[model samples]
Target: MHSHPDDKSLRDLLREQWTVAPVRNPGFRAEVWARIEAARRTPATWGAWLRLHLLGVSMVAAASIVFAGAGGGLLAGARDRHEREQLVQRYLISIDPHQSSAGEGAP
Candidate 1:
């Protein structure tokens, strides 16, 4: 009996037929170099970019903390029955009763 080709063998065959070539666009290269020079000349623009990046990073960090506290119940510390009940109550209060009852509140 003949054996069928496996996924790995097929992938190897496809890879063997493929060829990769470096991109060569002189116009695009020149545009990128010009942008680089322009950026270097504008120190204030670089500083503004850095400040905006830092602000964005801070916002992301704050949002991550809030999301973790909200979704993972990280602020609850441990799984006690009373805390769990309170959390469930808060969730029920926030959501529509029909939706909450439909098991949409499981997570």
Candidate 2:
């Protein structure tokens, strides 16, 4: 049988009641309340959260907008290239439907 310091078996202990002392010293409550008040006076702010988590995303988004505004000509070049390729494909299809551009023989 399991026994406590008083050598009382758990079953025997069940019939008796006991008092529990305070778990902490008297000032522990007041000190905890003071710490809580201090924390309330200076709450953890969102500035750190913004700087750590959102800053990279915000920077990338801002850079994207800036590049779009200032370097939008890049897209124009890509569009022109696409149009040129389409024109070439049409011309090749019309002029040489069977001849490969690589000059390979067709069976």
Number of the top TM-score candidate:
1
> TM-score per candidate, in order?
0.31, 0.30
Report the alpha-carbon TM-score of model 1 versus the true structure. Answer: 0.31
Instruction: Assess the local accuracy of residue 68 in candidate 1 as a C-alpha lDDT between 0 and 100.
Output: 85
Task: Supply candidate 2's per-residue lDDT for 56.
Answer: 87
Q: Write the per-residue lDDT of candidate 2 for residues 1-107, one digit (tens) a residue.
A: 74566755754666565557677688988999999998776636777556656878798999999988777788888898878777776677688885346433322
What lDDT would candidate 1 get against the real structure?
0.74
Clashes of each: 0, 0
Over 4 Å off in model 2, which ranges?
1-66, 99-107
**After superposition, candidate 1 runs with Cα above 4 Å error:** 1-29, 38-52, 72-78, 82-107
